[model samples]
Target: MQVYCTKQHANNGSNRFCTQCGEPLPLAVGQVIDNRYQIIRQLGQGGFGRTYLAEDKNQFHQTCVLKEFAPQVKEPQDLQKAKELFEREANVLKKLQHPQIPRFHTSLQVKLGNKDFFLLVQDYVDGDDYSQLLEQRQSHGKTFSEEEVTTLLRQILPVLSYIHSLDVVHRDISPDNLILRSSDHLPMLIDFGGVKQLPASQGFWFTKLAGNHTLLGKKGYAPEEQLRQGKVYLNSDLYSLAVTILVLLTGKEPQKLYDSYQGLWYWGKEINVSPQLEAVLKKMLAYKPSDRYQTAEQILKNLPLLTATKPPTTHLTKLKTMIVAPGRQRANALVSKFHNKTQAVAKSIPLPVWIRPFAVSLGGTALVVLTGAGTWAVVNAVIRSVTSITIPSISLPEIPQLPNPLGQPVSDKGTKDNTQIISRRQQLEIPEVFFIKMVDELFYTSKPELKGRSLTSKAEDTALRNEWYDVASNFLDKLEQANLSTATRQKLGNYRSQDYEIWRRQARAGQLGNYTISQLNKDTNEKFDRLFPGQQRGKLNQQTFGQIWYAIAADQVSKLKSSN
Candidate 1:
């Protein structure tokens, strides 16, 4: 709420009151000051014109605070003094530079009610005031801890020394006027309304302000000398510091801790200041100004350093720790976590409805479908036969006559030629086993051995086509008698790979030269590991391979999953 806006004066109406201050205050919008500062927001209004958070539009992003005061409001006798005082504060601020001090960027005026009101533009700190800090601590149902009080003292002491070095008596020091940093939470002295810059080491001698002094500082903060109808000294601020610290630690007004009857600070019964620091506070708050720390530098030289930072909120602290720059690294990290690289588990493609009748129901499914009354014997017998068929060792025998290099031409004329070919097929059943072994070779080579050698891996030679099918039969027969269920063997037979490989022999032999690799792949699809053991589910990761795949690396050991 550092931003305060004001309304303009009406034309027809005769309103004596200022549209901004709610009193007969002065100042209006669109009034420029010093021809440099442009009054924007009406920060506050007093008998003196107004205060505004304004800007220098000519400079990019340049912001300055503007305070305007009406000349008529200054009492008749003190009008000149007040104008001089206001200007003096501006001039004093110009020369000051410290972390705790607010800078006076420029000072000028804006016209309001036919009177020129001073507009002082200064820096705007984006932070809370010391009053807000107290309110926060009180809301949490706690007083500032001793460590916290000590830290506040340490941080402000250096600033105080700097201010005093400039020969300026702040004259006013309280919580409402203290500014604090949001990032570090350190306190900074602000609002130099009563700042008086002394000449070198000589402070200006001014009339004692009694009632004004008491209202300006809390009871116990104004040193007795300052209150006894007297002038102020450098120790005045230190006395106020002691009072501020006492209130900070105990969350009580400083006067409450004193026992006037005892003529000294009351301790043990009503106050809780520790003995060591209590001595320090007592000396600081001494009735006579001379007994206290006269300068902020002397006070700090003796006191230990203290630092306190606002502890972060749980969510904010987490945010601070996890902040990541937005760009490629962020994108890549997210993608890496979820990208699908490993192969998916193999799944059985549903056999077309037309093929359902041809499937030999010879396993657990046979029992399931038979419903046990009539088909029970056949189903049970089939299951028994399937389980009983042990895997016989594959002992390769002599190779048979695979079709001749240029076999006998088709027999439209010779019916005897067809019968002779048929007779030969029945006599030599060796091709069935040989074709299966050929697929095994292709599969094995596609793995570890070939690695990335797809180009060299193709078997296009005339001899190799005869050979792929020649070995295919071996893998098939061994799979059939391996105690696998009849349904399992049928499923294997339907595997696009093995069947395609069988059909591919003709295509590979240039019988169907137009056939693509896809056609050959489908014809001889030797997709093994369709029923991988449960433990190896995601290892090979083929959909049809879970409890349904060939034995491979990890899944190969002793875990033979039964066929479906």
Candidate 2:
């Protein structure tokens, strides 16, 4: 028997890890989890846990997704915190009840060998994520049309509105999380791992649980506030959603499309969309959360009515060509079929005088005359009169001079002037109700900045420079609430005190002998050089290196604190 790893590498059933990548392969085929769900295959894995395709044997072989709670944290306190977050995910899913959202089944714990494995079962959504769909489209040299994307937004925005009404924020909204269902062709919002319930009031504070500070969301797709301070609001999801649409439009990731230095999105020239749609998308992708649309409802209300593009030749011109050309027999057959149907209906019930004149006149017009000047106008007038029947209007080309029997050329400039008049008339034909609806759906734009209230007491900048981990962490939190600049927020977010602590532990265990400074990435190495310009990189072991790294980070924090 063979089993597939999370990366979809085939392995022998008895193998503990993937042969190709060496990633731990937890569940083997036919392994019964919680005596109910039998593991079929590993679907995917992330930082949180591995998700598996499973069969609920007790429930008539129903397919479901079993999300395993397998955080890499080793400490008991961290493990307990991870468990609480895992349970919170299940609770969030249980509260959500929408057709577009996968239904939460149950959560169970089972012992696999000596370790306790926790599992969350949810209704298996059978479809490809938007990321996969976009890839498929790109492979064929195609992308989603504006109409298709607008329809997608219309379908998914209501789902966001529903969740937001329940006070639940989907923190992670990206192409990977949106699945296009095979059954209905509608997108389903999946993966509630980053789901956070909004506090009832600004004053109501919930106790900060362990692992709560751990950033949860994709980096490039997540807003600055979310990536920097782990702060997620209702509009945070909206920001990610806008990034997702931009990715689909340009067939490029958010990182590539956005100018991080200039803080501007360069998506306008890449794809052709309406000015209205572009404006709305820009607001949604605003740098500050307060500048974005406050709610999904506002987005829906402001969304413009999508209009079809004008064709080079009108439908009436095509109909005229079809009537006069060799395909005249086909057109006559269609008209004859309609005439016979009208006759059959007339025999059962008397035709009205208005309808009878139009029905009889259709037969009197010769095939050549039907393609002539006044005939097109007569057909259009009849079409407009039958508004009660709800028939679609046929677009007509501008009237051109009929060809003379002697075949004299007609003036082209006269035809050009007539086309402009017809175009203006068509524009005026649109109902006033459309404009009224657009006016009624104007967007709300009164969102205020989310800066918290000022602190009465202040801490000295020297305290942050003391090289204490507890002090630096508390200072970072205070700086976040103070509404610091983007550069300052980024500096604080990238601070690697955690990395220094890991090195400290490795040094205490005498494992520093096996490590080298060269293993650090280019960015980290550059940062190290800037901090300790004279220090020898080769001689800096984990113990000595951690000490210097810690001191440098502390000093930088102190400088930022004093400047603010």
lDDT winner among the candidates?
A: 2
lDDT of 1 by residue, 1-564 (tens): 011123433222223344554333423333455566565445445334456656677676365666654444434545455456667667778877764566777766545445445556677653445555555456446556554565466567766766666666666676656755422234668776653222322312111122234223345666665556545777788887877777766667666877677757656665575566677787888888778877765655555322112221110001001111101000100000001111011111233333234322333443111000000000000000111001111111111111211121222331122223223322332122122223433333434343322111112323332333333334344444344432232222112232233233433444344654454333222333232222322232121222133222112111211110
Task: Give the Cα lDDT of each candidate.
Answer: 0.42, 0.50
- TM-score of each candidate structure, all chains considered together: 0.46, 0.51
Q: What tens-digit string does per-residue lDDT give for candidate 2 at 1-564?
A: 454455667677566556795555668545788888887656677644578878898998777899876433336765576567667667777888887799999988666654556678999875567886676467446556554566567667878877887777787899889986533344789987763322323211111222425465787888988888877778988999988888887788888887889887775656557888888898988989899999887887676543333111111211111111100000100101112211121111122232232221335662211111111111111011211101111111111211111111112222112232223212332111111111111100011121121111113312211212232233234333443333222222122334344334433443334333233233344566764455454434222233233334334433422343
Off by over 4 Å in 2: 1-23, 72-75, 195-214, 308-564
Candidate RMSDs in Å, in order, are: 38.0, 28.7
For each candidate, how many residue pairs have backbone atoms clashing (under 3 Å)?
Answer: 59, 0
lDDT score of model 2? 0.50
How well does candidate 1 match the true structure in TM-score terms?
A: 0.46
